[model samples]
Target chain A: MTVEAFLPRDTTALALDADEVAAALLDAGVQLTRNGSRGAFWLEPLLEVKVNGERIAFGPVTVEDIPGLLDSLAAEPADHPRYLGPVEAIPWLAGQQRLTFQRAGLGDPLCLDTYRSLGGFAGLEQALAMSSRQIVQEVKGSGLRGRGGAAFPAGIKWQTVLDTEADQKYVVCNADEGDSGTFADRLLMEADPYQLIEGMAIAGLAVGATRGYVYLRSEYPLAAEVLVAAIERAREAAYLGQDILGSGRAFDITLRIGAGAYICGEETSLLDSLEGKRGMVRVKPPLPAVEGLFGKPTLVHNVLTLAAASTVLAEGAAGYQELGTGRSRGTLTLQLAGNIRHGGLVEVPFGVTLRQLLEDFGGGSLSGRPIRAVQVGGPLGAYLPESQWDMPMDYEAFAEIGAMLGHGGVVVFDDSVDMAQQARFAMEFCALESCGKCTPCRIGSTRGVEVIDRIVNGERRDENLILLEDLCVTMEQGSLCAMGGLTPNPVRSALAYFGEDFG
Target chain B: MSAQPSSKSVIAIIERWKDEPGGLLPLFHDVQAALGYVPPESLSEIAGALNLSRAEVHGVLSFYHDFRTAPAGRHTVQICQAEACQAVGARALAQRATELLGTEFGSTSDDGGVTLEPVYCLGNCACGPSVRVDNRVHGRVDSERLEALLAACRQREEP
Candidate 1:
């Protein structure tokens, strides 16, 4: 364990700060590995040197601080960088109880050896040893909910797929994270692809499935490349192939590139896209579990859901289960995005208040203005006001308050953001992006837009405002999918919270 | 004789995506890439191509809020408005950019140099206020520094 302690403020944001940090660490004499960010940007310039069993992380370092750091450690300016600190002690890194994003921000996401060293495929090994029921039980015990927004039970979905008597069950990992404020999925795919692969493999084992496909957004061409390469590596490693580890059971996965449609992030829409159809929302009744991904019993899971499954399998579900509150179990990777300090994925147990997310890790508003409102979930989620900051981060909790934990996306808005404008944006957004599968979402969205515009233009604003509410109700219940249903979240929540702004 | 482009919505998008599967994403990509926008004409075609009704295509496009139909400028300058970028002043930068360009997001400049788009994130978290011009990402772009990046597109008709 000769890995020296990486002192605080030695490493920070990588790549963009790579040259400066490298040149600085060089001045200090310790070589810095310009690796991928583990989805932790606040700890930029984080330098990692493996000791014995663990990799040490030092960061939030700058080019200017290198001289003092090197001299303080008494290391040659180009020799051993000072033992700054341990990887776990860094406050920003320490704060996050990473579950699904457990492997991200560690090292080169492309390196197979690195992934292997970090207990990546060990879950797959465990899955291979267990029966389908046992594997499902393990995930079920873990109480892990989908990190992708829906917070659906991962194990139950897998179990359903297993119960289905279909010959060709499929595992579809929804990596087309089109949410406005979340990039954790992309980060996971890019930084620790093996985690996702391991998650899918565990899913396949539980579901008795033999095929897996990852529908990644085309917006992430680079993540796609990494996933493609990781898939290849896994295939070569016997992690994915006709026969798994000489066991009769076989599971293989393919990378399906999404054209970057937000609707495809929806499971059924994703299935449609995977099936070579326009990314239209599919009506759910059979759900994807019975009929999904080429009309077979498919286990449609989010990247985070599958990644968490790996964690549960490797560490035992109880270990994760014992962490969080009722209904919401284990750690949640809350992508603390939008106008905030220390912005990145902050994984904590469920039940943490939005206030903590905003005031604590987020460090208040980024614009230094009084925070007006926050849009939880994603573009489709409700805009909660400052008064609602006490709301805990739980599915039931959000649901009770007319909101959602959709995809763990937290988009913040300072006072500079106009609620009227954001409200209008909801209808406008719906008008522009709806799949138009139903008349309610299609026609209502246009009508919603017209209503909002009339209000803004001060034309019969009061009557139009009432009509907008009525329209939202129709869209919410009448629309086929989330597009129309959740579209009014921003508008309604904004109206509810920021009514003055609308006027 | 040069082929006169068909005014039929289904005819045009089908012509583009008939060769491709993964209809929604690939078609959206092709349409956006080729026309620098997802035109409504193609939107109807996207529906027919996927065997979805016209309303379905319209619904899907409108639902997501990311897909656009209008034309983009010669160069697309996408400034990440996500949390990481915002922390480094992307909000102010986006405001300045939109103001400087004299056009809102999704609209091309009259001169056709660049169309500024507000992207969520470019995965360049560390850089903060990252901007992608066409395909090249410029990290840590400040107001003064943006000129140097935007200046490169002055000569090009499109990238």
Candidate 2:
């Protein structure tokens, strides 16, 4: 049989190119099926070998090692080099409570069989037995909040969409994960794509919506391709069609690619983009549930939210709620990035401390420099000094330190980092990407950049510090979207914790 | 007389919708995707399409830093100005990039071989000092990188 290996585009970080290795293997007359990663960035470029009905995984090997690997495979070498023994044997993976990401990095991302093998469609199967309200309750009981920037409760958003008055409603999956450090949405969608599809189908069933749209970011073209294929295969399998699992429910899913705009990750902005308009933040109060996605009632959720929902419905609410800290139940997919060995996706409990994550699992900074501060969340997330490193990764925990688990994307910064520049970037990024929907964001961001520039250059240093704080306050409170609103975090938090840089 | 949405009338439409809630992005995307950037006449079309006053569209068109209202130089060169890239001399590299293009950020050069735009991180932080020519990303960019990038763009444009 011809062998195929599905290599991810972002696998450019690998020590070996998948294409080259696959080619060399092909030259050796060996068949290989390139499967998608399971959000395990560290294990990538993770390779798998088909051993009987089951598949076994191996390294993280480079192009040069392919010849030796193939030779050993032919000889059935007693001990394979770079073999972590087995993927399941890895403590990092075995330790994870993978409900939503169970199939990620474990199977062929596009293969429907691999998914079915791992109990993928079983959740949708179980979901068909229950009414819409029952499904909503299960999600609500799971305490599964939105895994996007804002950790809003997921079930409530569905309930509102269900309650809204619309003949045609929508379920929008915000896969536009534009945060600097966060790759959970991208990796999750790429690896466990079916989980998202199942989650959306369940949402469609819960909210009484027949149509769903996944607004995936343009930066992640491969994820889009894989998801689009999965969605199609799901349609053919009757898991996402007019009659899903003989439940007589009709749901159609479509994937819309978003232009690279950080603002579109916001719910309303995503709606506007979905409607083929500019990606700009909308005023709340009417809220997305009431007036969203072409002014129709819509259920807007992050990729992680939907993936988790699939699991919650598959298992009872109590099963999911049994895990995690108070108010924050269920597992979280923690993406460890930036200047760290073993940089990849990590799934841990909701209340795990940043110390255990960064130092223990992340293996500290890859730069070999001292750890100064870490920016949890994306670009707009707060720059936390070492003092806050002990803070747990939770919704309330982030708030205590003035940070957020915004999409659970953890970006590490080494000692060589300049807090002042990071703070300025927060403002500059706001100025660059701001939709200009409101005056505070449109103008205040520009002003904030100017003030930050003054502070960085040592011009009117003491006087400018006051201006910087004031500007941050205005941007934080007055701006319309999170682009401007949350941009103050890096600046304010950096100043608060690592103020030495300002001098 | 009911105004028709031609190239000229489109400008009026753009002006009208430019100030409405979330107008620039929808307006920008619509104009750019449809006409390959916000053309002057299409401004009114955008205004009419989005339901805003002409002056409002004009104000927004000028307010935001990213919207390009006119045709740009042949090659689009986006410089990395984000901190991760800056840590590796992205600022100095940006200067080299601008000098090679013979124009500053947000402007087209006289030769029109390149148009320089200032962008935040392209998510290639691990490979710092990154730049993008059109949609392609080049890592570890510097003065030599800028020249090489410019030359490559020139080659691609030719037969």
Candidate 3:
């Protein structure tokens, strides 16, 4: 009998010695297959084996646990200390509304056969039969917005690209996920890369584009390698190359790597970087939709948006639309990080509150202290206090509360956190990453940091606080892009919520 | 420090990627991968081959944080100083690294054994205090683990 064992090849898993565990399993007469992460990070290096048609799990495992694990597996698997029963029974994973990440941690991430057996390209097949207009209508009706912080309606962007008359159009996936507390894009790319590839191909057919580009960040070398292999396999299988799936439509994706530039995550800056120029933000008017990427009509979407596009097609617009609250439809891939105990990815519908996500999914602070504040979104996002934790996590809802859910990255902080210091770091990050295209952002960020320093140092605290607010307003209104515009969100939110930290 | 690639190899790298749309970034990446850093001497060659001025090539190279003019140390150790990592004591860890390696961030150790730098995020956020030693990312890193990693770097450097 062939006893099959599965282990994650994810970065976190590999860091915890999943590779060594796999080697040990192989040496002990077990067939080992490297799989993607289940996103229950606390239980990572989570080993699984096929038992009576169920994937029984044992995890947070080390090489030392192998002998005893195998002994228990042969006799009574429940007897092992690391055993966690069947994987599906784990409440952490079972609670998620995993649409885009449905097939994560199932089998070999590079295995096309495994992907096909588990309903991988069903959406692309559905799309192959539909008209571009009909596809656009389905997407528009689904209410899917860009998941890369900017909640722009994706269908509208696709419609504009389709309506425009250009010699050539392109589909660019902004995989430059530079957000600190977020790894959903990297996880998607590394675990189920074909989903992103399929989504990009669908975008190509919908927008009348023949080429695509995935501007992946250099930080994610693992994601880069996986995407490269996946794109090649997809092209070989006729899912990504000229004449995709015998539909007479041509769409090929080129993987581009971004150097360490946080500002490049901005679309225009990303375009400039892609064109082999300095990553400076461009003025809006010809908005990338009409004139983009080599001065042609281009459809740009986040990795999650494109992946969700494929999901919308496979699961139908109404089915997805029925899941979430007003405007915000379908699921939100909430990435719990920072000082959280149970830090991982949680894909749930929109109405879930911050408090619920923090308590239920994150399990509060990792340090076992009372949670003080949480930063929603990336560095530019606001730090909400405990009082506002009950608010829903929808984009509109967050915006109403002087906050914006840029990306669904919720970073927890314990009682020891200094809101004043966090506010300063926000300005510091902006000053470092500003593209220098405009004055307000380029100059204001540095001045803001200085002003905050004065306030924290008790140098006319009241006056400096007022001056800091004015600086924030100038950056918010005068800056060319969100790099300067949204820097004030965290600063103002911290000052407003935790004023004591300033003095 | 690693030896710089010859001009001929640099031109070959540029020639290989000049035709593709937005090929300069890829060419730079390939050159860095092969030569350890973007050699200042090769800028004129890259500019000429790509039909851009030397100023333009230099601007592109300098704008990105990744493209370095000088070669890095034998091993690159990047500690994540982003908010996610900071919440879990990355600041203290970075301080510990600086003290142990006897070098500040963005500087090579005196022995040229390790280059310590600060990285924003490695997309391993769920596991806080992530560090990347070369291409492999290690998570849940404490000061002790960091010291061991640095010691390993030094051991590898020895004959």
Candidate 4:
């Protein structure tokens, strides 16, 4: 009998030597098929064996454990210490809504047959039946917004691109997920590349765009390879290129790799990088929706946003709109990471609180120390203290508390963490990554770092603290893009919550 | 110290991508893949072939941290020093790695065995402090794991 097992090809799984484990399993004469992770990261190198149509999971497995695991595979009861029973029944994964990431940790990442069997291309098949206007209406009615931290309504951007009378329209997916502690974009791209391709293709159909681009970060080499291979397969299968899916529409995507600039995560800077120029922020008024990518009407959406597009269309507006709460309809792929015991990807409805993510999903601090602070969003995101742990994960709720749910990456910090150093690192990060397009981001970031250093050392404590606050405000209000604008978020939050550290 | 990708190969790479609009980035990736780094000599050739100036090519290469103008050592060891990695004691690991290697970040060892560099993050935040040996990333690398990895790098370097 053939035994099917799921093993993640993700960076985390790779770090745990999942490849070596696979090799060991093969050498031991065990037949296994590799599948994407189940998002139970604490248990990664999480291997699952198929039995009776359900997958029994085992993990945090090493090459050392493979022989024993294989021996028990043919045992009467199929009992193993690492066995976690059915994958979906695992409490950590059972609770996730997983709309955008529906196929995230399941099928063979590189196999088209696996993707098809798991309901991958069904959305695009459904989308091919709808008119562009109807597609826009469905998306708008679904209340889908940009998942790349900006939180702008996706339908509005698509509509603008649709309305614009450009001879050439483009759909761009911002896969430059530079935010620390976020792997959802990488996970999706590597695990389910077709989901993104399907969404981008649908976006093209909706916006009259024949060409699409995915600006993938260079950090994710594995994801780039899988996506490129997947796109090639997609074109061969007629899901991309001329006459997609027998429809007369032509839409194709090219993968553009980003160099090591964090500023490129900003949409305009990403465009500049795509043009093979310096990744500097561009002045707005004519947003990318009006004039973008060689000054054409471009629809720019985050990897998660575009990946979720097909699902929105597949289930119709009402099915998607029915999930989540208030204005934040639909699920958010919350990346629980950093110094947390059970860190991994957790996609749930928008109303889940930060406390639940830390306690329930993350299972508190990894170091056994008390959890002190958590940075929501990316590097530029605010560092919330324990006092604000009850804050809901919704966009508006976070905004009300002077925080923005920028790309749903929650980086936890144990009591051992020094907030002063974190704040300095934030400034340092901005200084290193600032594109030098604007004065505040370029100069203010370095200046912010110097002032913070002074505060950390024994300088004029009260005055430098005031100066740091003022510098943060200037960067926040004066900078042209989020690179400089949001650099102050972490700095200010560090001061507000952990003021004693700064002094 | 060794042979680089021939000029013929570089030209072929340029010809393959030159016709596309804004194709320099992808072309650069191919060139880097063939030759470990984008040699200065090839930059002028690429610029001339692609209808771009030398400054434009240079600007593009210098802007991204991934593009290395100089050739790297036999092995490249990149340690994650970002906030997430730092929270999990990457700073100490980085210091120990540098101390053991007898070289600092962005510098190669005396024997030219390995090049150590500091990367922001490697997307293994949950399991970091992470380090990358060549292209493969290893997470949850404590001092012992780092020492072992460095030893492996040295062992690989020896004949």
Q: Please report the candidate that would top TM-score against the real structure.
A: 3
Score candidate 4 by DockQ. Answer: 0.78
By DockQ, rank the candidates, best first: 3, 4, 1, 2
TM-score of chain B taken alone, every candidate? 0.77, 0.77, 0.95, 0.94
Report lDDT (Cα) of residue A291, candidate 1: 88
Who is ahead in DockQ, 3 or 4?
Answer: 3
**All models: lDDT?**
0.74, 0.73, 0.91, 0.88
Best model per DockQ = 3
TM-score of chain A of each: 0.90, 0.94, 0.99, 0.98
Q: Please estimate how well model 4 matches the true structure, expressed as its whole-model Cα lDDT.
A: 0.88
TM-score of 1: 0.82
Clashes of 2: 38
The DockQ of predicted model 3 stands at 0.86
- The C-alpha stretches of model 4 lying farther than 4 A from their native spots are A76-79, B1-6
The sequence of per-residue lDDT tens digits that candidate 1 reaches over residues A1-503 is 12232321111242345566666555545644445566556555556655555565545566666666545444432333434355677666787777777667666676778888988788888989999999999988888877777777777887788888976888888888877777778777777888988888889989888888888876666677778888998889888899888887789987777654566777888888787666778887979899887789998888888888888889997788888878988877777766666667788888999998888787876568877788888888998887898978888988998999888878776777777877776777677667768889889988987888788888998898889999999999999988888898888998887888765
**Ten consecutive residues with minimal summed lDDT in candidate 1 chain A?**
A1-10
Q: What does DockQ give for each predicted structure?
A: 0.24, 0.16, 0.86, 0.78
lDDT by residue (tens digit), candidate 2, B1-159: 232336653465466545654445545655565555676665566666667677866765654345666767777888767554555567788888767767888888887778888766455554446677775666556688678778998888786
